[model samples]
Target: MDAEIGYLTPGRTRRRSIARTIFAGSIGNTVEWFDWTIYTVFAIYFSNQFFPSQDTTVALLATFSVFAIGFFMRPLGGWLIGTFSDRHGRRSALTLSILLMAVPSLVIALLPTYSQIGVFAPILLVLARMTQGLSVGGEYGAATTFLTESAPAKRRGFYGSFLFLSIALGLLIASGIAWVLTNNLNRTQMELFGWRIPFLIGGLASLIGLWLRRNVDETQAYKDMANKGEIPKRSLRWIWRHHRPAVLRLIGTSVLPAFSFYLFVSYLPIYAIQRGGATPEVAFRASTVSIAIFMCALPFFGRFSDRFGRKPQLIAFACAYLFFLYPVVNSVGSGFWSVLLVECFGLLAYGLYASIAPAMMAELFNTEVRAVGIGAFYNVVIALLGGTTPYLMAWLQSINLESWFLVYVCAGAAISLYSFIEMPETRGKTLD
Candidate 1:
């Protein structure tokens, strides 16, 4: 670690600079996820606004289709922004991604409903989600790269956990907002206008995230690579040619976390409310508390990974999921308290994967093409799996095979378990 070449500061100044970088990077990442998770949180309420229908399930299906559409756009975002991050800089790429997200949130907040504009409402809503999907795709790569590269090798797991913690915080905030609106507004009022409030707030919050991200310093690893003129002529090409194994492994290992995250955390409220017959107020309230616990627990797992190792923690998560998936899904049928308990326990299992996964992925690639490598592989898997969890669950339920959804999640965890077994321990290892 060359202090002069890294933070462009030494001693206390460098430490302060690192802290600022973490805050700036993590906040923008949080906002990106906040914007994303809010769509799911409010979809049950706003489905009628965009796709008016007699059948509530039909309207929800349409809304979730658009949500999945946003995910399909992520790989493109990953390709564009990942290249930009590798070529230009992580700070610039991250700031641009946040800027892209802000516009969509604002549009969704103020856009006309189906009653006012007919089918164009859903069309525009889909367009907004497309833009957001792209933003989120790029945000992960830049944010993770920046966070991992900014920290000391020994503390990388601890620092990288903030990225996932931010995700939990984003979801927690979305759930809290949802709970507040549901508690205050009756169902009709929520359908009428209450759903727009969180989107408006998210849009405004994006501006603050953009401001914070603008001030973030470039990561030392990136700085060093740039100074040495090690940037690839085509970063993605380099990744494909030289790092295909790592990319494939990333896709494999990412399946469990991505699928489980979308299914367990993002889709929990919907599952609880729709299938379990829990009230929206009860569901959102439980989500808020459970996710808060998840967020707070992330740093502890990260620190633990720093002391122990990445593979073992991930292994623990996978084994837990493999064994508990059925029971967890079964318990949700018992009502709100049961759903709450399952979700809270699920978060602990998820923490093992979320808190340290970024550090492990970051360790797999050198700085020159790290962003592109991560963005492409991770986003593609998420696009194919994570983004479609809700839609898949809905379809499964429609077909009277909803139990298979749990089995599907378990299969992903099995794949991830094998990957974890194969993965080298990355704790205390310097970024390549």
Candidate 2:
């Protein structure tokens, strides 16, 4: 571990360099999440274009089903890209992930509607989403590994928080675009063409992300591992044989965070409109404000973890979710201010987990298997739980059982709370 730490220079110059590197590393993540998120944000407008149904609910269910289908591809993405990141380098993996995301976004932007393409439209949409899912699965592992590895030892949590910060930025941008489009265009215009604009923007933005990631330095940890010939030949097999406990712990720790993230950040606005009786503009506006608050709070929470410990922050998040998620969900239709307040409150608590997740997860393994360890199991769990969140919520609402989804989220929180309790504190630890 000391040898690994030796690879990173500690100085003012290095500190200055770290900021640029973190931004460069995180920009691709922003684009990756932006591409991934716009699908959900615009689903209401575009659901009819691909899945024509007399019942809007059925069309949305179909749309969210495609969303869930895309998630099923995440594990495969995690495995393939995680292994690639382990073998090649984080920079290569990051670049590859962005390229994968860009093409799919462009494809979705350009594809014809069902009216023009018949049954092929939805099929094409599904294929595009699956490819983007793969990109995101890879993006999380690689970006987490890169950002955590690149930070100064004592400041890993503070730097690592940028991972989710970028995600929030992506969500903000997606929601902001959705708000602008919805406010500017009529229903027909949004359904016909406005929904495609975000995808086009995301696709073009990927070029900037690509160029940024391409120029950033590869992490010192990866460099040290390469110099020492520590790169694993088969990351997944090695992880199962040697580090099974760590991977399981990671999955457990992630359960609530993943579920809560989609529930609050991605699906909440939709819930407001469909279940809670809010308008699209109200939901989007509220969502945007809440997300901004969430994004702003991340760095402070992350820096706090650096001072305190990872476990306390994570435990706080789980307990907050377990106790408060029901009321938060119940507040969905209450009014604009109530919705905004709950969204901010819930996401602020969630910031406790989001801010330190990358560093904590990175501390679970050595550099060789770090990316893959997180990629393989983490992506699978997210696929099963996180990816299905919006679909499950929609399904529950359809049956007048939306409350059950709250129970489901709390159950996940309980599991995560237990996991956080059992896990050791990893603050100020050296990367191996």
Candidate 3:
């Protein structure tokens, strides 16, 4: 193998540069998730501010409907920006996507409330969400692909795992900020203005991410593709013709990670508040600690996968699915420490899947369709499974069938695990 061009190398200097690339890529993920989750964490307070209907559930539903709209735009964003990433360069695509996210997140942070502008408030909220959805839709696949492609082969799992460690950190940042702000304010102060603080904070984090991203180089794979004049004339078209199996496989494999990630990271706060009958402070604390524990372990699991192979890690995770998923979710409201323990356990098990799946899945497709094929399909599942998990859980809980939510997630995980068996083991394989 060519020492410099191959995924693995024995060079100390190259390892450090790979570290820098992963760090830069991880920041955008952090900022994107933080920007996204801040909206969810603060939804209870801000939903009424932007959308006031006679029934509170209806108003909250409308607010989350805007959230779902963001999800709807994600597939389109994934297809568009992902094609750009394939044709252009990964670093540039990532930088551009973060900027797209920053603008609307800042706008949402500072926008006027429904009380101030009537129906326009919700309209503007929907517009901002659409922008956010578009940004994230593009951000995930581009950023993760860059990080994975740039990392040293032996440590690809370790480095790639940071993508979600940073994501977990991002959620911790949102929940921590929301917890402090909500705790600081009198009820009126929080309702009036304090709720905006998290978005403001997200804008600042995004700006930092933008700055760091500026320093990273394009991936070698992309540079080679570009130099050969092999950038697909039609990235999307090539995806359908050549990579349909890879895409469908990703969609099924996506179900577990998407469901687990959203349930643990996105919806947990709401569940804690609404279903678990906990205060914001308690829920935020639980999420922070639980996710932090998981983040710490991400690199280890990822590095382990690099040695053991992708399929084995996913299979192992699947085998243990029954023991972890439902037990933890059902137990989250049991109390602070117990809920924390259970949620952290779930995240820990999820690490086996989330830590290595990005690189594993991306490697399955050819470079021509790599971007749109991976991004569009991967995000589409998230838009469905991840975006709707909470809403569906809420509905189930409303009907006194809350435990069934666990079964749904478990079933999804099982489907994903089954799909994993059919995937080729891509431990040290070359990416075309």
The candidate scoring highest on lDDT is: 2
TM-score of 1: 0.89
Assess each prediction's global lDDT (C-alpha) against the native. Answer: 0.85, 0.87, 0.80
lDDT of 2 at 198: 95
- The parts of candidate 3 lying over 4 Å away from their true place are 1-16, 235-237, 266-284, 323-337
Alpha carbon lDDT of residue 226, candidate 1?
A: 88
Q: Across residues 195-283, which tens digit of lDDT does each residue of candidate 1 receive?
A: 89999999999999998888777877788888986566675666778988888789889989887776666677777777788887687
Per-residue C-alpha lDDT of model 2 across residues 1-432, encoded as one tens digit per residue: 886567654665677687788897789888888888899878999998899999999999899888877788889888889899989999999999999999999999999999998999999999999898889888989999999998877899999999999988987787778768888999999888899999999999998889888988898889999998656587577688899889889989989987877777667877788778988778877878888988999989999999999999999899988998898778667489967987887889889999999999999988888888888889989888877776687688888897898899899999999999999999989998
- Candidate RMSDs in order: 4.2, 4.8, 4.3
- TM per candidate comes to 0.89, 0.90, 0.90
Q: Residue 290: error of model 2 in Å?
A: 1.3
On TM-score, the stronger of 1 and 2 is 2
Clashing pairs in 2: none
